[model samples]
Target chain A: MNIPLNITKTIHDWLFSIMPEGVATVTEWVIVAAAYLALFAVAGLYLVLLERKVAAWFQLRLGPNRVGPWGIFQTMADALKLVSKELTSNANIDKFLYNLAPYFVILSSLIAIGVFPFSRQFQALDINIGIFFLFAVSSIGVIGILLAGWSSNNKFAMIGAMRSGLQTISYELSVGLSMLTMVLLTGSLQLSEIIEVQRTGGWLILQGHIPAIIAFMIFMIAGTAETNRAPFDLVEAESELGAGFHTEYSGMKFAYFFLAEFINMFIIASIAVVLFFGGWLSPFGITDDITWFPETIWFVIKVLGIIFLMMWFRWTFPRLRVDQLLTLEWKYLLPINLVNLVLMAIIIWLNWTI
Target chain B: MSYFSDIYNGIKTLLTGMSVTGGYFIRARKGSITQQYPDNRETLKMFDRFRGEVVMPHNENNEHYCTGCQACEIACPNGSIEIVWDRQVDPETGKKKKMIDKHIYHLGMCTMCSLCVEACPTDAIVWAQNYENSVYDRKYLTKVLNQPGSKVKAGIED
Candidate 1:
């Protein structure tokens, strides 16, 4: 009756029982890595399909519905096409870095995903400074983008890479500050601990009140910019820069960049889920007595809701100008985020949280 | 201050835009205007004036409205229409009459301009709404409008 199912823990224990301690730990790590890799790949493909479907609905159109039932296999067909496509690139391109760039982008996202607490006791990695680790790993993707552009030997790619770097760096501040505001309320950087705090206190958004809402808004805007999606998508403005940093890439290399993007979106949405929406906690304990309904389902539902919001933002808002993007960060979001953080700290000091 | 007001206005406008899209998203099932092209072929209706292609209608008696006047041939800008004709002896009148041997239409060359249909004095040619015009061979596009042994309708010339 306490939602007493911890499947991941049982699996961990069973693995240890069958092997020596060190070997068991190594095997567990391998299994977790493989599971996460599979999850990331599938999630990326489905997220792409979801984005297209949502975009169609917004524009009063019918999206892809031919390849499979309701077009479920459309992205799978796209993956096959990309795989069969020839890997074409300029002869003057730096071969080593050009080949290495996509892995950097994809690997960073995969690493960031490992720390997410999908449900109680379901996290692969539970590091003490989990949020900080996420921030650090997520930024490594920009290095990959920069390397790709520099090695591509194309002017547009170079300009796009520069824009991406500028955008990521500027928005990273607001993202961190907004998150730091919530860290004050929960008093921990570890994701699981943050969620555990929420289990009793209700969602952080409700507990911290006005400042929490402000931080949530700022976080969403900055998170969207960090992912380099539309509205802040100056990095690959097709009308201006022509496919951006991945301009010279083709076949699976281009697929890597594209997949990394959606995975990064999932990561951001997951973080928002953990920090503000009580991670896997059922709302108001309405279904606490129902043992059949798992906490992981609740977690996934929250993440998807946030992902839909981000997609809505992408389809609704026009891409911001480069200067306007910078102004929004420096002139508006940064100041507001900093003030919101302090207000959160003050509210915490006075024991004013609900 | 204007600075705070700007922030407030920006947030308001963004929410307003989101609400519009959200409203559509909720009603998206009923609101979508897309026509499933191949699937709805049975129920699909083309407009009355849609000039998909040119066709010559034949009556049950194998008689058509064309008088072999060659007006459509001359009116066609692309020369898509060709009328091959011969002077045949009319047994009833005991006189020579212009009759069509072949009424060739080159669908490949046609721009669907409807000029030939407009030029026909006897309303012989009209637009057909069949849009699936693809063919594996170019020869398939060149169609003869009049069937074999078909003759001009009685009193059509007068």
Candidate 2:
């Protein structure tokens, strides 16, 4: 709570001094909510542009350079195009569920973004159950995909949703187990406390060494699947599903789904940075005294590096068949993750980890 | 034992694939194959042998090599080329001579098979490297291959 001259606290104090206590709390929460929404609205847009640019580079091409300088405003132009498109509606589709699904998908990703401790002073919520909350909340995103597919009154959409649900559910186990391995080392689920442990012990990947590396690898693979991305992206396997669960969605509603996909990617990368790379912790204690460069900058740099890694995975690998996808989770990731968790426990018990 | 090896091999192949793409990503600045089209138009040059469109080459004296033999017109599968010839009195010879009035080329209908160039006896028509043949109206695609105020070379005879 002793954040050094944090802007959020300063604003809260100023608002409290000006207004009555009850009204001040509500108004402050409203303003904070608005700020979070605005921050992510821009972040989601640019993250997509970055993903495209990264994919383009991997394939030896310039992704976008038309909308603005280096196509910086490419996503903005895409947003305008999506907004201008007509929302085609079908009579047989379940209207309520069809409309409700996109909000749920966007909500899960945006809410998870709040749990990240961007800097010492930048966390919106420093809940003790931070890691647990992120898993629980992000899992609901699969439900949105399911609803979208089921309500669209399209067979292809239904198949895509079903695939997504299956992939996320199975992969969630590996993601949780890998995270549990790290939690065993840190002995705390709070994201801030995990960073604090890493600040003292160095990054978990370095400190815990072999087991942490295994866990990190497993986590990344499962996290990729959890987000319904390639090579595990059987959900909307464009060749087969024609855009998957959100196939029936168009215009602004489709944009919501697209934006949520990238935001979820950001959330996953943030979590990876927090747990394994040591969120906001300067490498080799190099930048500890460098007041000019903030911890948030380090956090962002690490998160972007991980996001690039994910993009690398996407462009490099082909889509796994549905069977191969499930086999990857059940036969490969699950077993390795369970064994890695056991190894992590024994290492901690023996006081052998650095 | 095999299970452990399976996991190891799986990770090994995945990393190998990642390295290939990672290398390309790193080398992108030096190795990108992107042609920035309109931006690089001024510097862009077509290959000498690129058969973009056929043209009747005119020299500085406003004369071309076309004899209006109609061989190119006969070779065209799509009838994209039209040769209009007329019997005109040759001033020097004092005899009626067949001279080409116009050679029309409809680029819209052209398949660019290079058959016309192959059939031209005098090499009057050759492929021009200008590929940007798109026009707003379809009628604009029909072009007169012979430049205005041009005649057949005086020394060219059947």
Candidate 3:
């Protein structure tokens, strides 16, 4: 059950031999951080395309097809137009916070990506408490929104931001607790460890238990709220508020908020993919047997599917009222999540290990 | 009892939504019956009597039915029409006559109302079914119907 001392010594020597100099360590962090930012941008653009296509499918109308094949480059054209647009603070707003708000949201969203494990060894920094770290980074995104809303000094902006903050905070409890159940089962907060647990044994969804099923459902609905997507996008209700928080801000600054939102949508979907569906691991022995098949591609497909599903939910359903949204969280979801947490702890104590 | 009732209610609600969608799903084949004017304008080829913008049909003389009576201008609420004129010499009678110099209509301001056409003494201008009127440059918008080079022969025919 244990490694021989001689074999362990040899492995240790091999590891140290591949280790780089002190300057190389700094370069490694810089490369990973830069890569994370690039991935953040790519994920944002992909979400925009997915949203449009999914919306079109639901509404029974062609969304965007002129820019490129399947309207893939429509977001790029939109970005170009936004870039050329005049940055106007035509309405009076707290200039400093209003300008800085979008960056804050983008930063928080991008940081959350660091904690998501794309593939087993493909993560930037395999932080030990990855799940906790992800939730923490995501929770901080509301601060930027709140600042944007409050600083704008517009009633609509303030109301929208306040709704966003409350909805996020309320739903996150269920989302975080649901994630905690999986972390409890694996006994590790690291996402890679959770995926490995699912792969060798089976995906948690296949593990037949009432609590796990309930938790999965709660996690998905909560994740939708976390994204501020439809059925919960009271924050940016165009009918109610002109544009919510970014009503006053125009040009690239407004665009940044939009991009951050789509990126955040991906972050939610990625977490769902990692925690529930086997992350990077194929559905059956089908993928595991093929050594030539890349795990990263499988992982990307699953994440993209999750994003598409979120986009579908946004377009297929009407939005929830502010009171209804809060009620769903407090009355139904929060209780279910708490029960799931308690039940999961019992399952773990019973040593339900495959 | 409550749990069963709730489940029943959820099912009923879901079926109701599906029914509404089902109706549209069936009718989606009809596609709102819109012309998609930009892409398929050539194929649909609306008839000349489509009641679009009015065009002054020019004869061999290019003389339009508009007599510069300000009827269309007065009828228009949006101030989209301009009637200009100059005196012309009647070759037969050797008399000065008020002739239409130009009729400039800004389609941007025109609401496509048939009032001007209705008020016309002569039925020279009628709806031409030309709906593609998007343009840039507000100054270029003010169109002159009777351009400078238009040799409109207003001489009476036998």
Candidate 4:
């Protein structure tokens, strides 16, 4: 894989030369972790504002222009309000797991974001099992939802948790299978390597063309379900479940669950961009000649494009019925995903990818 | 196959729905229905016939047409209007007259029913169309319709 010039390397090299190796290594890890956390905290806040604005636009209304210019600080205001709220609790519930759940959910999403190749220079880490790591870490969030529901001692929360559990379990297969279809073309599990392959072959969506399109469609559908977003958002189907698994959580704890959701959405969109669209790779290599334009700009644009698509899906589509949610994954997505995978295998065997 | 067509139809419908939202998102700049209420207050004009609150109209000379007939006071279902009058001698007619001292309109009790406006014989009271009548204290809602220093206009026949 091509190691692009990264800022992290400069910092690491400088630190190693100046300080003892053990102290330098620890300090570098701390700096990187703090940087990622700070970046995502800001990203999470704005993403909520973006979703609100997009939803308003879809409904032909102007959203939240009161807090700051075009209501950009609306989520910041919401965060402040949420932090000051009381941690209301039911006396009979299991207190330990109920309290622990939101942190679990938030941490899982936060950890997955570390592996994303924002730009070649901006990646937190380029582990060989990057894609695998993301999938594994992200799924752990379902356990948090399950714990929150069970410990809440509420029937609606339990049902919502159960729905979330079943939905994530079933849809994850499709998410894996569809992503694997693209991975087949890249011939690597590492996300950076996948992007490196796309750099030459163009976007995987354009390279594999039809099958890639199919896989894209499947991946998006499953990823939406995995994130517990709408169309597949039967988990918090508010009409039925009354705010779902995080129903009992209040104050800062509830905010953790809420923030985790937007962060998870970002992670999903980032993955879609890295795998299908060329991550940090300019379209048609148009910006390659312009030395001044940063590669991270391309990555951000592509990620935002995918996110807009996801938000559009959320606002347009109605929530699926519990049975329909399962059927969509099992009957529709699973079958099409398998067929698409086979078609991709054949194409790869024939060396037909661009 | 029917199964394949089902999948195709599903995706087709999804795309169709997406396009509808996408169309709105694109056209939102010009088509947004939000009025930005407080910001647009200077330009916003309520409908002419809007029944906001009852007001007694007067000319610039502070001469109103109310004769203290108590027609509106009787007509109000919720006892929202009260006309307090004192007997005074009319200089022209040399007769005792019920001249209004204060016309009390309890807006807190008003439902904008327009019954009082319809019941007035002299067309003394009409809808002001000033809907932003909200106040912190309930007592502040009880407004005097007639401006201070207003008096009943002198008439020929009455």
Best-performing candidate as measured by DockQ:
2
Off by over 4 Å in 2: A1-5, B38-45, B59-63, B84-102, B147-151
lDDT of 2: 0.90
What does the lDDT read for residue A94 in candidate 1?
96
Clashes of 2: 0
* C-alpha DockQ for predicted model 3: 0.20
lDDT of 1 by residue, A1-354 (tens): 223245666877899899999999999888888998899989999999999999999888899889899999999999999999999989899999999999999999999999988777667889999999999999999999999999999999999999999999999999999999999999999998998898899999999999999999999999999999988889989999899999999999999999999999999999999999999899997777787777888889999999999999998999999999999999999999988988998999999999
* Residue-by-residue lDDT tens digits, candidate 3, A1-354: 112234434644555567766655665667667777787777777778777755554555556777788678998888889989998874677889988898899889888888776665566668888899999999888989999998888999999999999998899899989988877777788888888888777887665266677777788889999978887889889999989987877778888889989988888878888888888788985766665566777778988887766665565567899888988789778876887788888876786644
Tens-digit lDDT track of model 1 for B1-158: 99999999999999999999998888888979895666566787888998888999999999999999999999999899999999998767888999999999999999999899998999999999888999999999999999999998877888
For model 3, give the TM-score of chain B.
0.76
DockQ of each: 0.70, 0.75, 0.20, 0.74
Q: Fraction of true inter-chain Cα contacts (below 8 Å) kept per model?
A: 0.71, 0.83, 0.02, 0.79
Any runs in candidate 1 off by more than 4 Å, and if so which? A1-6, A21-23, B40-47, B60-63, B68-70, B73-106, B136-155
Per-candidate TM equals 0.91, 0.91, 0.83, 0.90
Off by over 4 Å in 4: A1-6, B40-47, B58-63, B68-103, B129-131, B144-151, B156-158
Lowest summed lDDT window (length 10), candidate 1 chain B: B35-44
1 or 2, which is superior by lDDT? 1
TM-score of model 4 vs. true structure: 0.90
